[model samples]
Target: MNSIVNKSLRRLYLLGKTVRWGMRPCPAGARETRLIAGAQRSGTNLVMDILERSWEADVYHESDPRAFQVYRMRPLPIIQELRKRSRAKCFILKALCESQDLPELMEQLAPAKAVWVLRNYNDVVNSMVISFPRTHEDLQRIAQDRKLGGWRTEGMSEQTYRLVSGLVKRHGDALTNASASALQWYFRNVLYFEKGFYQHPDIKLLRYEDLVTQPQRTVSGLFEFFGLPYHPWVHGMVFSSSLRKRPAPELLPEVAELCEKLWQRFQELEKPQSI
Candidate 1:
């Protein structure tokens, strides 16, 4: 009877602590007013790095617990704190699309502008497969790291590899399968010519190809879009930055054909007239 009572008391105490922490106000100078969202491996990191170097933009590379907790207390309250901290007009929040808490974040940053970056779907998938292997052995390794049962131990099949491969073969499938991963990239670009929030007037859409092919023009346009002074040095810096390293794999003829088709589709989607 004493043990049961003590357990109940402990639960109550933890609940109270959680509520208290949740209600605490976020510290001054810690919310982001600007944001960058995109699929993984889509140059979001590079863009953030360049923006920080050129514009003196305050960018948080990952989600901050304090900021998140504060955001939970009140939407946009963090923005005020960020403004106070940086004493800059813009604060950039960089987060993986699928991982962000959308409704809450959107509520807080309703009027904020966003930058969405996209890469060819085949490239994105190929990169993921290389970096995050889906083989049973790889899954087992991941599970061990995560303190979960290994795939073999858990009696899970090795079908994850096939499933991931199939999904990557479909263009824009990342946005659909991992919506937050590629949400802004897929959705906003698709609706760029349209009006309203779906089209997001303040959002700027950029392609990884353009960044690679014409760094100067692309960075210049980005700075201008954000109302920041265009720095000549930024062009060179962005170009010289290390590209994401990927092992070269001889593409199957079919995959190569698919990549070409998707690349063409991307070109069609990015025509200036389309926007």
Candidate 2:
């Protein structure tokens, strides 16, 4: 009950700011959609919550029926209509499932920008095991049945599919749920490279660790990239308690190495490039 009231109060505060800021014309003088994409257990929700506190933005959570149907995005036309109807200058949408199609979606919604959040695989798997107990079984099906089509398999390349299948085959029935969940993380995030996001000017890679440990600077940088005004209160809700809260989930040595390699790649990418 207290949580509900707190959420409502936060909304009221943001709405007041919206009305105050809405009196003036938007700085950009045009609407912009900010797509937040990442694996399910990554820190996408944390970023979304921060942006939702902004006066200039309207948020569409994956559970919002108006923008999503069972976590999959509604049709493009419907999405465009939602953006058109919203009075806020920024339309914030969570598109974790549609992450692989980010490039195409950005082109279709030109003037849109995206941020893909990366969390440590160990932490992500830990959260997934608790939040979605079915993840391991679900991923097992995807590995054994390549024809299974859903958000999990959608946009998955043949190369990645084979890689997952091969990994599962090596472990056979001995694959632990934690390991399966880790593999799920691997294939989903690998698309960041497979889709050529490294060179995509409009897309930014965000590290979950950075956001929690250095919320102010990290979020300020993201706001700058998206051209949204910064608000101190936006990052207030973020807490670092979740970081390494539990011993890293045990996984097969090979799977651990794979996830670690990808994690290091994300860290390297987070560093600023030479001009």
Candidate 3:
């Protein structure tokens, strides 16, 4: 029958398309690729700064146009161009990508390294209150585009924006209180990275608090792990009076519980490993 034939043809076409996609050449490179991934405002930039200061490694921040521009383009080309452009013995790209992409990035780049930065949940939530879009309109725009996600606001109520703003007002830029929605978003990104890369041999997890108190030793260890030379760079790094403390946010009961569980899990991962 015409209907049966049409269905068969459509299925066959899809099968052919998949085959072509699979056949596309994977990226090949001798230059090592390292991904710096973590929740937003978790001090990935500071980590990168240390990496840059302590070693001669090439570091790319997320805002750099090169970071994910070619993400949509087919394979090989992406990493190939990255290597050719960076020309560093090893290339570090700061990317907060999905856990789903971990296997492929490893499979395609084969032996790619990753670094994850962790910070206190309360501090992170508080920092986000200062850093993220303060207006309800800006928050709505982000939800629609979800430039970052697991997906954010997927199951949460839209009133989350109002809740966060209210926290800002009560705490007065300290955000000593957090909304459940913000905690959920943080948990998803942090937990996803932990579960995906916890067992991977090439990944390293660093704590912001440690990096704050003891910069030289921590950075030297990271460079040594990456097989790069270590230098005295942290001495030149600037510190703000704000780094020592924030009035820790008073979290809601459920938000606090989820955040505590996340802390416990990350603590286990933060153990000093051989890089």
TM-score of each: 0.53, 0.93, 0.66
Compared with the true structure, all predictions reach lDDT values of: 0.49, 0.84, 0.57
How much lDDT does candidate 2 score?
0.84
| Model 3 stretches astray by more than 4 angstroms | 1-30, 69-76, 134-177, 180-185, 189-194, 238-244, 269-275
- Clashing residue pairs in candidate 1 are 29-81, 97-180, 98-180, 98-181
Give me the candidate number with maximum TM-score: 2
Select the stronger candidate by lDDT from 1 and 3.
Answer: 3
In order of lDDT, best first, we have 2, 3, 1
lDDT of 2 by residue, 232-254 (tens): 88899888998999999999999
TM value for model 3: 0.66
State which candidate has the highest lDDT.
2
- In model 2, which regions exceed 4 Å deviation? 14-29, 273-275
The alpha-carbon RMSD values of the candidates against the true structure, listed in the order shown, are: 14.5, 2.3, 15.5
Better of 1 and 2 by TM-score: 2
Worst 10 residues of 1 by lDDT: 175-184
